[model samples]
Target: MTHRALLAATAIALAGTTAAFADAHTDSPFSITTIEYGERYLASTLIGESVHVADTEIMPGVALAAGTVDEWDDIGEIGDLIVGVDGTLQAVVLDIGGFLGIGERQVAIDWSALRPVYEEDNLEEYFLGLNVTQEQLEAAPELERTDADG
Candidate 1:
């Protein structure tokens, strides 16, 4: 085949490939265009993973914050959840209390609610400010409540 003809064929193939890529991009109806740490990592993947919340000026007691963070704190393994408070992901919840590591507290916050922490050279994990309180956790429905009521 002639060089010009070969080049023309190659250009046509490239155009077709580009169009295919464009089509694929539009086909992704569930594609995540925006980033949401809470929904992407904590809400889905971190359900069974250890959650960590570091001790910092913002979050002095990790347990208090964790208990007050979510409504599902009555069940599950929470020790695996490590929440960094001052490093990067600030205001994140990290519960560290329970029986035989079976009753760890639940801590969760929307990604949009976290305070943006500046990534530092010495920083390790991300931290954020949590909207939690000790009273809220204690007020949670206990496991014995339903049993006792019946």
Candidate 2:
């Protein structure tokens, strides 16, 4: 019922499913061995898109809202058009910042604040299209962004 509880359930369910799917690994070069999930959010470097750890690593100074939880059932997908969907916590939003390799920052995100993207037909494109900017992300009420002087 609570946000934290929902996140816990989502994490447990995702971990269990991932464990079960682990044995199906193939010898292909693209085969993934392990997919580690974290609790922090990352700001996408590119606007209008979802950020992935595969593309970037977590940055410093960004903090994830730890322990927040949500239900997997409540976690809906943008549709059947995306590569990732069910079993993923709806709260795992990306936190991207900076310019072209300039002051970029990233994080895994709290898995309790995500809202399933409603359009899966173009999930990647849709996520990549998100207009979130570094200033907006840094100024996010949920985040505590400060300069070195702070």
Candidate 3:
């Protein structure tokens, strides 16, 4: 009888220990945090990514400025990012126009103007969107960066 009682107490202690371990996991500092799929992107993948412009709005001014109401224009490609002194990304520079590097120039647009759209079927594939018109981009002043060789 003494041996049986000792064995039962041991079993109860073991069960309590298992329960405590499980609870600890739920309250641990190493508990899981989630960054949902498609929410984050690699900078390397964004460089040289094609940027597109489209007339997706129906406001009168927008329609007037947009010219076409339902067309997508491939405007430019991502060139570089402008970072603030405090380390925030403030703007994105794009390489607009040129056939084989003949007439291409860098133009900087505000960071807020960029919109990234990821495909539902493939997260690895995505494109950047800028809501402004193609003409506006073409007319933007060229962004000048000092050359390394200079």
TM-score of each: 0.30, 0.24, 0.59
The residue-level lDDT of candidate 2 at 109 comes to 45
lDDT of 3 at 39: 54
Candidate 2 regions exceeding 4 Å error are: 1-95, 120-136, 139-150
For candidate 2, lDDT tens digit of each residue in 57-145?
32322332332111111111121111135645433334344455355444434433332232323322222222234454466553233
lDDT per residue for candidate 3 within 1-150, as digits (tens), equals 699999999999999999999987787675447744335555677678888786563221111323231246877788887778897888888888897778989898886677665444444445566788777877899987689513
Q: Comparing 1 and 3 by lDDT, which wins?
A: 3
TM-score of 3: 0.59
> After superposing candidate 1, which stretches have Cα over 4 Å from the reference?
1-26, 33-45, 48-96, 102-124, 142-150
Give me the displacement of residue 92 in model 1, in angstroms: 12
**TM-score quality measure for candidate 1:** 0.30
Question: What order do candidates take by TM-score, descending?
Answer: 3, 1, 2
Residue 84 in model 2: lDDT? 37
Supply candidate 1's per-residue lDDT for 94. 42
Q: What's the true lDDT of residue 138 in model 1?
A: 46
Candidate 3 wrong stretches, greater than 4 Å: 1-38, 57-71, 119-124, 146-150
